[model samples]
Target: MPEVKSQVDPSDASPFTRVRQLAQRAGLDGFLLALLGAILLAYLWPHFGSDDGPLPLNQIANYGVSIIFFFYGLRLSPEKLKAGLSNWRLHLVVQTTTFLVFPLLLIAARPFFDTGNQKLLWLGGFYLAALPSTVSSSVVMVSIAGGNLPAAIFNASISSLLGVFVTPIWMALYLPNGGHNSSLWGTIGNLALQVLLPVVVGVLLHRWLSAWAKRYDKQTRYLDQSIILLIVYTSFCESFYRGIFQGYQLTSILLLGVLLLALFFGVYAWILLVSKVLGFEKGDTITALFCGSKKSLVQGTVMSKVLFPDARLAGIVLLPLMMYHALQILIASIIAQAIGRRAAPEVPVPEPVAGT
Candidate 1:
């Protein structure tokens, strides 16, 4: 007789598979986890990423930032960005919410947080508000939720481009609130080098590099994440080396987490109400909520090095954005999945009949 064998259920998977499944269910992005790992690495080994360290990570980060934006420009579709422009009302709502209401919410909450240590965290929140909407993630979420894909693409792309201007201006206005009049305009000239110039070059080269961008999209994405990790690591390394986090307590971080959650829900709820008031259809509403409510971590990390005069400031100043980025992705994912499921057309079950 052949040896009898027991079959394992698919549910009983390897530890790694189970963990991955759990992560999917919870809508966790690996990039967010990698960010935590980068911070941990920074804390554990600040010396390697120090300004005077052997690797010259600062120079590497500077160069890497340009490359990331270059790839961004290479992949951007000028036609697709223009396709959704007919819906001026939707565009108005999305852009207004992103550039206006988002910041106002932070300003409304300002009085509660402008004290000593809290002031820094509040400044971080304002920076997050000032940053523009994300691109890929916004489009991805809107697509999943059965939203207006064209408008999603348009608003998200425009937001990123606008951020190259709007964010710095907003920061310049708010930096004074923290009693540090860091000349964000002076930084804008630097931005034109690392941020704008590369974007312009990439756009000019788009006809040639577009195909390459499509073919190696995944590889380019990994490069983007790697550069981001490097930036985070290096910035935090400088901060830790200089003892910038010394004044911050565990409670302060916990409070920041609470505030970030509130901000996410706060903006989300506000947009949902506005979309309804504006009589937007389901698709446009979803686009408005996801696109308008998001803050770009890519822009945040890329701009941080230039925005803050002190390398040490980048680490703390980035806390609110990193937190909000992780939070929005998580919450938006869950909401999108639920909405997708609800909107899915139900297939009819077959009824047994005369055959019997």
Candidate 2:
């Protein structure tokens, strides 16, 4: 007689288990949080419009981001940077793609965008290209895939440092000077303050507080993501409030979303292939593909205040940045799963051992 096995059904007994199973099945509880935040924004926005009612939650969220960045600074360590510098070549490739190759692609695509809602969207795409690679997400993805975490931390930090200069140069070359946009010097100052300053402070205190950072990593991480999701919701709210999305047909925006998605994944696939061709091991390849393809939403928004100013196009300028941020997280999470499985192969058992 064959033995029988029973499987547990989460739905039958506990509601808690059922929700957990559902979230796992759909993948990305963070994304679900982000989506929920967006829904809340849509619901509460109308009430917040009046002067007496209350301050807009979006503005509250932006303030939260500033605080988040300060804590982000507190958490970064010099050790991570030093270790990443040891494998400078791997970091170099990722930085080159993020700063150099990506900008070239965006520039090349400009002619195609010359007609039809292309100009604004092109600026958005260029903004996406110019921004730095992500730190937290890159490290998270690498860790999840069982890849090199220290290298991810190093490369991601270095990329952020490089963006302080590189992103402005790209913007100056691509965006014609408007009367309101900040000069290059002002942009640099803003970058120094908003990005470099906090990170530097974090590094300076690393020796004293690194252990605490490790212990509280999970809590800080949740706050970090919540802040980003808030930023996204607020950005979209501003765009929606300003009638930016309304000006364009719903179908057209949907089409652009698909196009942007293709562009994102296309570059991701290309990098994965290139990393393999360049003789990177599976772990390094995973790092390169993810770190290379990501753009930093936090940097873009912080810069937008100085670069674009309190202008009508601010929200529109950031539309591509928003789309790219969400897309990278969703797509990379999926790819990381696949790469992790491949990298950790299952060995076959010898059948003769049983007979012996």
41-117, model 2: which lDDT tens digit per residue?
Answer: 74457234222236665556545645655666677666666766777667878988899888888887788777546
Reference-based TM-score of each model: 0.91, 0.80
In model 2, pairs of residues that clash are none
Residue 184, model 2, lDDT: 72
Task: Count the clashes in each prediction.
Answer: 0, 0
Candidate 1 Cα misplacement greater than 4 A, ranges:
1-10, 176-181, 345-356
**Model 2 segments more than 4 A misplaced:** 1-7, 10-27, 39-66, 345-356
lDDT tens readout by residue for model 1, 192-288: 8888888888888988889989999989888998999899999989888888788889998988898889988888888889889989999999999
